[model samples]
Target: MTLFVDMDEVIADTYGAHIKRVNERYNMNLTKEACRGGEVWQQLPDHREAIWRHYFEPGFFRELDPIAGSQEVLRELSEKYEVYIASAAMQFPDSLKEKHEWLDEYFPFIHWSKRILCGDKHILRGDVLIDDRSHNLEHFVGRSLIFTSPHNVNTTAFERVNSWEEVCSKLL
Candidate 1:
């Protein structure tokens, strides 16, 4: 089975970092607690790219933290499937590289042959696609693990889960 994984909010808390950076750089009173379900960008309309640039411009993915239990879950999943890092992060190439490097650092157990990077994850054609974006799920062709996003509630799905731990259970 080919398991397509998304970077950002699914494995790492990129959205959280974005929020913190926005508050720090723009002196906004926004909190990471408020940027949920598509509200992340809404909270910082003035300094959007500034926050993104802070993390992905020079490539900050190398220092990012995987979501709690993310490494363990991916490690286990890798044992049973072909794990592919298929992300739609082309809008930020440097950030994408950083994310891939972080995954390689944390989940080295996965073979290089199993890793697949792409801009549109729907093209990967995996048995399962795990992503936080609702539109991505609509584009995918198989079973999907729709990770919860504070900013995407307007989009709906039948298989949405609130956390990676819950996804681990459902997938296993």
Candidate 2:
């Protein structure tokens, strides 16, 4: 079975990266709990533009830390199922290239052919989709697993997995 995985908050800790960038830039300490139930940018209402700019900044995507256990879990899952890194990368100018490079450095096992960087995820056809954004999983025809993130802590419209370990218990 083909398993489609999202890059940003699902496999990569983009949510944490956003919060870290804003906190470091503004000289404030913002915790993940502070941004629960919504996007990190929402936590910094006065600095929304700064938070948004991070996505456009060069090296932002490349500098993000991977979600814990994603590399090992994905590498092992690849041995059992057809896995793909499906990210909506066209939202930012530098993201497409940076995301590709980031995946190469971090998840080299996911071949170039298995990477799908696009504007819309509605085109994806697979047996399972694991993503952080509820909107991305809304239209998926197959099983949708909402990978948990601080921003999506309140999401309850679909199946959810709080960690890669939870994913292993469910999918592996």
Candidate 3:
């Protein structure tokens, strides 16, 4: 099976990183639970532009912590499927290189050739796609699993997996 996995909120803890920075900068107590069904910036209207700018900053993607259990679960998944890392890297041009480096550091076994750092995911043809964005899953012809993120908490368009363990239970 060809399994395509998204890098950001799915395997990388980008949401948590944003929330952490926002909390530290503004001295507010913001939890993932508090931001459910909305983007972190949406929760902080005044600082929304500042929060969105985090993506444009250098090394932002490279410095993000990987979601817990992703390494182990992806390693196991790779053995059973033609696992490819599919990231929407073009939204932020700097992210392409940073994301490449991040993947090399955290997921070297996946290989450079298997990574698809692209503009649009609709071009991909695969058996299964695991992503945090519902729009990406919307165009997928195969099985689409929405990896839960705070912004997508209320999205019921696709099957959702809250953790790598849930992913393992379904796809592993």
Candidate 2 ranges beyond 4 A from true positions: none
Cα shift from native, residue 87, model 2 (Å): 0.3
Question: Cα deviation of 63 in candidate 3 (Å)?
Answer: 0.7
Off by over 4 Å in 3: none
Name the regions of candidate 1 deviating beyond 4 angstroms. Answer: none
Residue 103 accuracy (lDDT) in model 2? 92
Question: lDDT of each prediction vs. the true structure?
Answer: 0.73, 0.90, 0.92
Can you write out model 1's per-residue Cα lDDT over 6-81, one digit (the tens) per residue?
8778887776677666667667777655655565666666756655456555756666667778888888888888
Pairs of residues at least 3 apart in sequence or in different chains that clash in candidate 3: none
RMSD of 1: 2.1
Sliding window of 10 residues with minimal summed lDDT for model 2: 43-52
Error of 1 at 111 (Å): 2.1
Task: Please tell me which model should have the higher TM-score, number 1 or number 2.
Answer: 2
Question: Residue-wise lDDT of candidate 2 within 4-91, one digit each (tens)?
Answer: 9999998999988888888788888988887788888887788788788888888889999999999989998999999999999887
Per-model TM-score versus the true fold: 0.86, 0.97, 0.97
